[model samples]
Target: MMRSNAAILVCVLAGSFVMAQEPDTKTLFKEFGRSVKSDDITLSFVLLNNRTVDVLFQAPGKYAVRARANQSTTFYVQGMPEKDMVVDTKFFVEQDGHTYEASSLNIKNFDGNTVTKGTRVDGMIQLGTKLDLTHPFTVRGSHGSVEFVLSPEALKLAEPAPAAAPPPE
Candidate 1:
């Protein structure tokens, strides 16, 4: 009887494992990055921890971010309901017929634990936080956090300050 019970328990656990929902972190991150770079705009995302709001990015920059509890959406205008709290910023890139944007930060697994890439010369970067775009950086937030940024090249065009009106009207 004990043997049969053990077998049944093993089978149940195996079944659960097979049915479990596990996110593909690598693919998700890559996709996020690609999307950001493909579009020249800043986007926003909501961090979710334990099925509750963790943090909110006023505006997600231009890149991509994938964490355990985060999702993102992009919009072109305002007055629309906040879908996941999307915000547009002055950061983004356009290339190969697509636009890419910045993310608040990029976090990934490092040394068997999650680590933010602070600022790097040839790696990902955190979205909203400022950094040298030519250089690279990444940020990790509590629960789940990710934002996008614009490449320096794209930022120049994306951010078009109106010409000063001759000092005064």
Candidate 2:
């Protein structure tokens, strides 16, 4: 039987490796980074599982909220020690003339109707399944937008190397 994901996490944390039911997910973090800027706001994305993206927004502090994406939403707000602040404005993406809104399951800093600000980024955002990384895509919000394509170097970094064979008993 397949081990539970929590069990797998614990085994990995103990410095022992647990082979996955699938070969491709052997690495801890299977993701690639892409970033862009709109005005003074910079947004970075790590496509964590092709569809799940961690969006990091950096901007001036004491900012107000705005719309960034459409559809069901979950937001995260974190305050950096460096005074950098982030607010997840509802965001939307336009690709191939169709609009796709990020669906997030994040409840980290949620406070009733607001996602309370803390010290981090949005680990939510379920990107569109049809998100094309090979081509340029744009992410837009109330302030501005950024357009970018996945870089070959960045993609290469996301490729998982095979795990080492277990040591002698």
Candidate 3:
């Protein structure tokens, strides 16, 4: 009788495992990318390590990204500032044919001269902006690919900034 019970338990556990492994990366990203183009795109989800965060260009130089998390759960808000400089810098969307210069962005508490020291060996960009919850971003790095997701709302929060300069002669 005991042997029979043990076999039943093993089968049950195996069935549950099969059910757990759902949503392959390719399928997940395809759905996520489509949502971004929707009129109302508000999302909040977590990701695990080594997952692929791929962004396919929809328009000329315009990109739509589907970033998968690496081994942890991170938050996303549209227009919100990115905490990890290297990860945040990756999203340099070139709109309207003008190459947006990174140097032109003035973030609070950031000394432009010292910013380079903070660049990750993998080339993460440092960005400072008002914490706009409406535009929250989630791009976590793990394994080879970092997952990137954009929030639908337009989140906002003020950042510390440098003092304005005096008029030149």
Candidate 4:
């Protein structure tokens, strides 16, 4: 009876460990856009992870992506303001059987000076001459990469408004 009880206890503890080791698949949603003098577009989507991220793309420029993980820290440099850390900084989009890459660097100040060392890297790269967010794409950086799929719900978010009915007759 004693040996049987010990075996049962071991099995219970093992099961608990396994359950704790499983990764959590949390989802996050964000939508934002801005215009500086030209046409602007707003993008919204669901991320597969719980990390907070911002995706920005200028009409005639490149895309700037930032992400923060659980272990990120906010700190201030000697002469600079507080900043958050980011990890594994890179971005890539796969469309029409072609892959485009963007290089990322550590976040800097307006004068091109490094503020605080962060796990997240920030940089801009030319996205060619077209911008297509309809297709699925992935954003990768120091922390890691996440693939975003345009679900039916996301499609609705990207839809255009209906035309006016003949100027109300």
The C-alpha lDDT values of all candidates are 0.31, 0.44, 0.29, 0.35
Cα error, candidate 1, residue 121 (Å): 9.6
What is candidate 3's lDDT per residue for 3-73, written digit by digit as tens? Answer: 99999999899778755644455654443332121122222222211222322223432222222122122
Write one digit per residue (lDDT tens) for candidate 4, span 45-154. 23211222322333332212322211221111111223432222234545567777643333333223433532222333233333355676554333334455556644
Counting clashing residue pairs in each candidate, in order, gives: 40, 8, 26, 13
Which residues of candidate 3, in runs, are more than 4 Å off? Answer: 1-5, 8-18, 33-50, 53-169
lDDT for each residue of candidate 2 in 98-164, tens digit (9 for 90 to 100): 7778654443432213322334444445544546556666766653555655567545533444566
lDDT of 4 at 84: 32
TM-score of 4: 0.34
Per-residue error (Å), model 4, residue 28:
9.6
- List TM-score per model, in order: 0.22, 0.43, 0.22, 0.34
Deviation in angstroms for 113 in model 1? 29
lDDT of 2: 0.44
TM-score pick, better of 2 and 3: 2
Off by over 4 Å in 2: 1-43, 50-88, 110-121, 159-169
Residue 13 Cα positional deviation in candidate 2, in Å, after optimal superposition: 23
Better of 1 and 3 by lDDT: 1
Stretches > 4 Å off in candidate 4: 1-90, 103-113, 117-126, 129-134, 163-169
